[model samples]
Target: MPERKPRADALRNRESVLAAADALFARCDSPESVTMADIAAAAGVGKATLFRGFGDRTGLIHALFEMRLAPIRLAAEEGPPPLGPATPPHRRIPALLDAVLCFKIDNRHLALALEGTGGGSPYAAEHYERWHSTLQEALEHLPGPADSAFTAHALLAATRADLVEHLLGQQRMTRDQLRSDLKAYTARVLGSPASVD
Candidate 1:
């Protein structure tokens, strides 16, 4: 059977909920503090509407995160240099990590909310698996004894939302400092000279 398109009202409600949630997450001190009720109220929808549109808080977070991450994913899969597959793996790997770091930093609250959604192993996340494999593939292409799988995990660890928040909030490290440190750290791992640019 052909699936029915979502009613216009349904689509509008979805957009409203997502926009409200995004704004709340962007400004909130803590992701956990933003509740479904808060989102519903912010969107001017009922609690039932929020629940009906999204299964739960986690579902809403996942949808919002996916929307935010789509561009980076597209760039990695098919876009131009630095992030695209056409870029050499050595450069692509660094670029991927840099993008990931910036994404988590820019969307810190949303990222943290997604990360803290459940007690399940974070490795189980679909996004985690996709990025892990992307990093692992690039790492494998480089000539080295680096355990690509472990290296991928370690590289990703540097961009964790919690770590980014800690360093930026309490450690007082500027974004440039973090980027430079990450670039230098990646260079040491890959046995390449760090580029000043």
Candidate 2:
């Protein structure tokens, strides 16, 4: 049988749950501190409703993270300049890296939670694969021979959530400084000082 589409109320409840979860993550010092019960209460839904909507805590976190990432993902997939298909390789690569870094920084708690979901290596995640392929394809367009696959992985490693948190939260590196540093480092890898942006 075909899966039934969610009713209007179910859709509203799902949105409420996600919004509540997002707010809790933003306010909490630790992601584990925010319980499913708390999210249900905040959303004015029952625990069963939460589970029905997202299956489990990890599922909920993944859904919320994806919801937040939708805009940037759309931009990278189809939007204009530096993030879209129309942009030049040299400009697009750094723009892509910068977007990943900014996303991690802005969504630190949620990203951290997603990373700790016991789902194993983050390298296995669908989002990671998509970002990696995009970066790799762009790297292939550079002037000389280079291992685009490995280069993409290396660039993404620099923007991992834990590293971003350590630099921003523990080490107290400002956002602009980190971005500039990443831009510079990426330039070195691409073998073009002019590409730093």
Pick the TM-score winner.
Answer: 1
Which residues of candidate 1, in runs, are more than 4 Å off? 118-120
Displacement of the residue 82 alpha carbon in candidate 2, Å: 1.3
Query: To one decimal, what is the Cα RMSD in angstroms of model 1 from the true structure?
Result: 1.1
- True-structure RMSD for candidate 2: 1.6
Candidate 1 lDDT = 0.91
- What's the residue-level lDDT of 20 in candidate 1? 100
Candidate 1 weakest ten by summed lDDT: 117-126
lDDT of each: 0.91, 0.90
lDDT of 2 by residue, 1-197 (tens): 99999899999999999999999999899878999999999999999998888999999998998999999999999999979978988899999999999999999999888878757777866688889999998888887437889999999999998899899989999999999999998888888784433
